[model samples]
Target: MINSKFVKQKEVSISVPPGIDDGQMVRLSGMGEALEGGVPGDLYVKIHVRKHPYFRKEGFNLVTEMEVKLSEALLGADKVVATLDGEITLKVPSGTKHGMILRVKNKGVPLGGNRRGDIYIRISVQIPEKLSKEAKKLIEELKKEGL
Candidate 1:
């Protein structure tokens, strides 16, 4: 429902299409002002999408960042990630580097019918700020092995 000075206050049905971006306009024909013996003007409504705390949209694709420990990046691990549908487990291959993007197919924005976009997860390798003596020794040993 909307209130307009040029038209009577009434309820208007607006169907938002899938994958519509912010600032896009939806025109409502014959819903504006009408003059004597003249056609009524159209009403234009602009869309504004609120930002998500965990994901950002790009086209139909959704992007998010995931932090992995240094050991996890070096070794393979299965991590649980939150998705629009629900939570899913993602596999991080061994030797996965920082800034590597992993794609989960058909997990993004709806594309009408039965199609959907993809979700991109960017890996962020977290290095420990403070290392224990034993951990430092193990890293030193790895360095000696040309790791």
Candidate 2:
């Protein structure tokens, strides 16, 4: 419901179709008031989509970032990632580098005709922000071993 000076307090119904991009306009025929004997004006609604906290749209594809532990980056692990549909397990390959993109097929926005774009997950390895004494010792040992 929207309030305007032109139309005191009236409820308007708008039907938005799928595949409508942000800033696209949807026309509502005969919704605006006519001038004297003239025909009613058409109402154009500009669409604005809010940003998702865990997902971003790139064209038709959906992009998101997943944070993996340092150990998981070094020794592969099956981690749960959030998608538009829901949570799913993604296999993290060993020796995976930061910012590497993993593609999940057909998980993006619909592009009409049953076809959809892919979902890309960018890997972000999370290093320990604080290291304990034992953790520091292990790192020193690995450093001494030329790791």
The TM-score leader among the candidates is 1
Candidate 2 worst ten-residue window by lDDT: 1-10
Q: What's model 1's lDDT at 134?
A: 100
Q: Across residues 8-105, which tens digit of lDDT does each residue of candidate 2 receive?
A: 45688898876578999999998877877999898888999888898899988999998999889989999888777788888999999999999998
Q: What Cα-based lDDT does every candidate model obtain?
A: 0.94, 0.87
RMSD to the true structure for each prediction, in A, is 4.2, 4.6
What TM-score against the true fold does each predicted structure earn? Answer: 0.86, 0.78
lDDT by residue (2-86, candidate 1, tens digit) is 9645547888899889888999998888887778789989988899988989999999999999999999999979999998899
Candidate number achieving the greatest lDDT relative to the actual structure: 1
Question: Which regions of candidate 2 fall more than 4 Å away from where they truly are?
Answer: 1-9, 132-146
Give lDDT for model 1: 0.94
